[model samples]
Target: MPASLSGQLVVAISSRALFDFEAENEVFEAEDDHAYMALQQQRLDEPALPGVAFSLVKKLLAFNNGGPGSGQRVEVVVLSRNDPISGMRVFRSAAHYGLGIERGVFTRGAAPWRYLRPLSAQLFLSTNEADVRSALAAGVAAARVMPLSRQASAEHPGELRIAFDGDAVLFSDEAEQVYQRDGLAAFREHESERARQPLPAGPFKPVLEALQRLQHEPGMRIRTALVTARSAPAHERAIRTLMDWRIEVDEAMFLGGLAKGEFLREFEPDFFFDDQAGHVESAAAHVPAGQVAAGIAAG
Candidate 1:
């Protein structure tokens, strides 16, 4: 196991925040086998997420399959308690698609996972408020019990820092496309021209908002970073945008084509997410990274 995963407590989250699982009626309908099966068939082609959330899920599946770091040192738990109606279906679909989540129970109740006592990364799928709350509470317990953060001056278990790309993760990608299509010079001119304009909603907006609530918790178990390719003149949009979104991102880095791998190395992020392969390639080397495929046209 790598030092990053060693003695670390990490959990990846998936909910209405990252994925719109209830978009189709068939997804929730019990009678439409064909529609449901067709939906199931589409899981492989599901778009990648913009934060480490997706990678965290994949890593969780890997851990479930006995990949590595499967002892008392780490623990993996999936909490689909958020969308009580859809959590089980999503878990079942993942298992049906061949991601071995052995001995996992799908229930409408909130239950502490005694089975995940040992593991580096703990992946959780939370849909219910109680479930998500439970997962965070468990995370708090892990920070107190984990060995990794024992010597660190910080009072938390594993720190559990998460990194995100701003444009897509925090605010809508409506303006991002303009920047990409028009190039940096034009993008900056446009953003500087419209810095105070209201920002559109992004996929993680709600999740970020939830994090803000958690941020105020007596002892927060998470920290976030917003790393974007946008530079100075275009920066306030992100700052003000986060303000408008009301989510607190602890560290905000606005790099103009600067390599993220180095920053990720120093930040020691538990996970990082970017919409571009270029960024993911670099960051993945230093942190547990994943690509967000939303808003990206199919290649």
Candidate 2:
């Protein structure tokens, strides 16, 4: 029988997002695939340095180490556009880092987001904007991981904390456009008007639901936060949306356009996801950050 990913919190990640392939990626972008493939082949024996999402992935996979039957609770797979030969290095690097990642799909240069369906992945992390958008379009929770973001500290070894922006992330960017086009007063009024109506689902909603399920499992030490720029009147709709979906986060911060860096520094999340570049720029300095390149922000 085929291997099963059922009943698992499956995460589908790209090679670049898992490891520091920026140098090779530079070649791939500036020159051609042949050069990049050659470089990857040459570096097959070298283990890659951890990328932005490494700590988050490491901490998440740790949830599976409770002995024999524990592995059934979580699964992480490499879903990349790298060629099969380059994929060799990916597996080798995982082994080198003592990561138990075993499954992979190498598509050479083709788009890999399509495989998320078969893998039943609740989260898809990649450095490719197109891939992230494609996955989000397919109803998968996906984020364009910031490969240059600060790595999470080893301080919280046992707990996995993840932070998320409210608009264009857990909820649709419909409200964000209001704030961007009409300014703060209009945005607040719009959200206040629609406070009773749940906002439309965004790219990260599926991942939140998956994490909520994981939180219920025995021995799981995952904590999630909703860290947004919305406050007071605007915060109600975001809260209502989560309530409507019957999902609850461990924490929520409505910063009202304030800088999120210091607050995230205190939260110490293994990873943080935001749709706006400004928030991500601030948060990345303090915690590992990924940009959800969806909604109006990406445009």
Candidate 3:
């Protein structure tokens, strides 16, 4: 058979999401690709500092160091908007950081979401909003990485920790839409009544499902959490939904509208995903965070 990424947890990440190219990103935004390419060549030997998703990427790549999985095989591909020449620096930076990323697609300025289908990427992380939206529309679990977000600490080098929000992230925005259009009381009441019904799948559902497979890989250490603003009566529905899907998280935090930053600090996740930009910004202060940009709040 042809070389394939089958039966693996495949992730597609952008050059900017994997490395700290904030300065170069600005240059690309203000000038043209030529200027950006020139700068990359000028600093060709300088390896980039790690970006927001670096820790998550590094940990996921660790699964491949052994390379055997019923589903633990992990492949991380660089799906970037940078030119082919600039891609050299991306590879060099990954090499410098010891990330074994061998596959990539450099599209210069065009949308890179077009390649997600071929890769069958379970997750797509990028700094570009348009590309992320396109990936979500195409049914790929995608997130707009917060480039300026803080990187995770090296306190736990042996395990990979990941977190996600509930409504509009792991679950559909139906309950969230009810809360937005109505009020908290109504949302709780709506959820309580339909507690047994499964909420529709959100963008990150596939990503979580893929992680579940990777979690069972021999000798792999991965932790996942469901941190949401939900609490009590409304929270029952969330739990039931996960049970309905037969998926379980290592931890679940129903903060009931409490600020999530400090709580996330305590959890010390390598990365966290939230659909609300406010929540993403809050969690970014304590842990590496990304915005899903899905549902009503994202608008």
Writing each residue's lDDT as its tens digit, candidate 2 over 2-25 gives 888988889999999999999999
Cα RMSDs of all predictions? 14.5, 1.9, 1.6
Off by over 4 Å in 1: 1-158, 218-220, 297-299
Candidate 3 residue lDDT tens string, 1-299? 78899888889999999999999978988998889899999999999889889989998988876554343488999999999988999999999999989999999889999999999888999999999989888988889998888889788898889999998889889999999999999989999999888889898888888888877775459889999999899888899889988898999999999989999998889899999999998998889998988898887
Best-performing candidate as measured by TM-score: 3
Kindly report which residue pairs in candidate 3 clash with one another.
none
Model 1 Cα lDDT, one tens digit per residue, 40-117: 456534542222233333333333333344432223344332333345555554554454333233333335333233
Return whichever of 2 and 3 wins on lDDT: 3
Judging by lDDT, tell me the better candidate of 1 and 3: 3
Shift in Å, residue 69, candidate 2: 4.0
Error of 3 at 130 (Å): 0.8
TM-score of each: 0.51, 0.92, 0.96
Q: Which candidate is the best by lDDT?
A: 3
Candidate 1, residue 268: Cα displacement in angstroms equals 1.0
Model 3's number of clashes is 0
> Against the correct fold, how does model 1 do in TM-score?
0.51
